[model samples]
Target: MSLLISFSHLISRTFLLDFLYLFSVQIAQQVKLNKEFFSLDPATGLDGKIYGLPLYGGTDALFYNPKLFEEAGLDPNKPPKTWAELQEYAKKLTKPEKGQYGMGIYGKTVHAVRIMHYMSNAGANGDILRLNRKKNNSWDILVNSPASLKAWQYLRKFVDDKSIPPNTVELTYPDLISLFAQGKVAMLTTGPWGIATIKAANPNIEFRVALHPTPDGKPPKLRTAPLITVISKRSKNPNEAYTFLKYLTIQIGAEMAGKGYGVLTQTAANTPQVKNNPMMKVFADQQKYAYFSAQELLLAEWLKCKDQAWGPAWEGMLMGSVSPKEAVNQAAKRIKEILGDKGNLIYPVK
Candidate 1:
């Protein structure tokens, strides 16, 4: 988060990213103290910066009960391949008759829009906001592309088709979680964090995690959210933080079999040392396909793009307020506004 954009910091002259980078450079030297940090070669990037090194990699999986699959006639061992299968299984598993739902999903929640990037990656035709990757160093919006639109329509199915409860719009993070704990929703598109909640809720729910389902016949290609761990500018122990960050991401992550944490940072997906845990293994598998947000650098523009891009467009689709074509156009226009004229490549970085 850039303090420069913060409402309170609005009056402050310094931009947050700029300020953070000043400290980041110092920590880079500290991190160099540790020779073992070699997974992501900072030198690979033109700036010699491994921006994602501290953040590691992330994943979204279905954490369901092993026991529930058997009871629901689902092969917990072999999770559903497509969204249809997931919906079918969830419908069967959700027995409001038995005081349980098929699946729990947070609908219309404010932050809900933020997480929809998964849909785009799962083959959604468009996103509310996009970072025009073809362009040079500076970033700009490219939201509402065909890819973003396709993803939006596909993800909305679970909600529009009533796969989730109609009143799902009433559900927020807390509400959805509570229902899931009660076993109301049998399956959900979730990350590893849901495991503890499931266990805490019914101890016996028995759940396993799987890749986010694909849209109809589309192939499954999940997108991991960004969570970079930059060196705290004010930290007294910047070196320790940097060391820990590097060690945790490189050595420890590679060593774990199924790291309970959100993601892995090791670049080599199939390295022997990365074969430590099943959880880590699942994450490591994505090193090849994983993509962080394109709008990641341009925070303000991306957020604006998201609102005009996917959010408005998707709402219309869900409410039948607009056709996908119109939705896609709206998103694109917003992206163009943010992109200005620099929507193309530039001279390569020296």
Candidate 2:
């Protein structure tokens, strides 16, 4: 009986692939990964026939304070669907004199994705990274493109208009949620995880979530991150291991969804039971446009690049220390340096 190494819920599909790519044959040969669960993102696994199973998924959405909407005379039930409307809502909702802010801008490393996610919805198409068949599986960076510039500029406006919290560049995950739960901010760009966190913090707070807003009139594109599991090729009982893998990811995974846990199975997501639940239904509907970012599968180097490169650069723009275009150009240059030949800069890194 040979050992079966199961990568379930601990590491990501990206890390698993990295391990396999670097140590193929010596450590693994053909791992069983459930790529079907991510049909929303067609480019999820570029290397084909790789490792892992699937797990819970989460995506960014617009979470708003219904009470604040009523107070500001905006439609509480109808959250802003476009960036233009969001600006107007924020204008009305912002009452800095009364310690209320329109939005909670999370510019910290982990939470900064909230802003970039919204940017992607605005048609930036992942901003810094894009898939081009012409590039032979490599990616291109568009951080300095006009769409990307507009996205950051809008974010900068939120800061300049005093529509977001003071010193927003410092807020991160639970911090922004805490502010939103406390009624200090009227809206947030968060996901299902935030709903639970907000409820636990302020059980009586009245809040609602809508799909992420877009600049165009069309529906927004959604972005998601999911935990995936994989079976190492080292396993001797490949057939037996896959049977258990399906049970864990499909069978039991469906059962866990009842408790508000994420389910990667579209069947589980579209189950009549799940569609009946408002929150789960929202996420299920959003899955159509949700895509995993390149960082999830390309190179682990992107994680450090995001933190050390874009994090500070975005913060600088928000703080008025740098212009939005300048900030983005700098981020593009740094990302190119980090990605090297693997990522070509669409805009010159000047």
Candidate 3:
């Protein structure tokens, strides 16, 4: 009877311990990051609990490798103001035989992503895959404009000079970021994801993130890919999601910019931390200058012609590919093909 009592007491204690541990874990999981706000999110269609907010925390300013610029006798504080200047700086930064590159950018990729974010600022419109696909595909506001052609022509100088690695042809997003972080490339235009990783990988590197240089003596009309928090249609706790998202985005989550995590597209400018930090300030000020890329059925098709026709077309024309008129015409012709593929014919030349 004494042994039986002792054994029973041991079992009871063990069971209690196990139950407590499991309960603790459940609490931890439930409280993960933004989980607490779900109760307030708009599931019951309650306006008191809900508000409208545009997308936020989607991008950051990009910069050049400052140490490399210094070595090349360039001032890191002053980046190139225009495409002509950037190309020139790249030429100075290039040191090929030892496997150094001047600029690390998307070179010859499909889906036309680079021009979508950075190209439009030069008064371009590079979103060719799905124009007006989102609320802000303003990327193609000026796809048919002369400035659009000039932006492309400027890009070819890097190609013309072979400033990037030959493998740039096969480079993807990860490849480019990795190469840039290693100081293999002199300049790169990117946002927080690259900043977050690069800081982790090469924290001490002489680099600073800044606005992507514009070709026309100003910043490009800014547009960045935004990371959004949306309530899932199928979520059992959609109200939970809205509650969580509102608190995350509007309250606690807005702190991401301070921690160098999220971009805070909506209140970035107003945030004390964002306003105070010089690095974060660039983005906030640059925000005023940004507008999204083209948006419409078949906008992407027109963007390609703007890109392909401009760079080689305009550069070659300036360097001699065909006359500007001929080049523009050729670009228009190519756009027709891309449009036709999507069953959304843009050029009526057919």
Task: Highest TM-score: give the candidate number.
Answer: 2
Off by over 4 Å in 3: 1-55, 108-111, 124-145, 229-245, 270-273, 294-350
Q: Estimate the TM-score of every prediction.
A: 0.68, 0.86, 0.63
Give the alpha carbon lDDT tens digit for every residue of 1-350 in model 1.
11112221211333534544554434454445223332334432324455434344455666555566788787778877666777677666765556666666664554433345444554434344444334454443333445655655655666555656657655676677666666666666655555555667678655556665665534445555444455556668755666676665556555442434444443434455346546445555543354544344434344555545556665565566776567666656655665577442121111
Compared with the true structure, all predictions reach lDDT values of 0.52, 0.70, 0.52
Which RMSD does model 1 reach against the true structure? 6.9
Model 2, residue 12: distance off in Å is 11
The residue-by-residue lDDT of candidate 3 on 1-350, one tens digit each, is 00001111222242532322222112122334322221222211111222222234444466778889898999988888777787888888899876789887654443344554544654433333233323332222233345545555566567779886766655767787778878898887766556667777777776776776765667656554333333433446645655565565666655776666544445545578777776667766565555432221113333345456434444344344465445544554555554454323232321
Q: Scored by Cα lDDT, where does model 1 land?
A: 0.52
Point out where model 1 deviates above 4 Å: 1-17, 26-52, 55-57, 65-68, 94-101, 111-130, 133-143, 215-220, 231-245, 251-259, 266-281, 307-309, 323-328, 334-350
Mark the regions of model 2 whose C-alpha exceeds 4 Å error after superposition.
1-18, 21-42, 48-50, 110-112, 124-126, 131-137, 271-273
Instruction: Give a tens-digit lDDT track for model 2, residues 1-350.
Output: 12224333223344644664443232123342334464434355555433444456667778899999999999888888888888889888999899899977877644445766766755544466775656776668877777788888888878878899887878777788898999999998776667688899999998887877888646667656666555555667766766676677677767666455664576678676677777666766676666676455555566656776788788898788999889989988888887788778887766
Backbone clashes in each candidate structure, one number apiece? 37, 6, 32
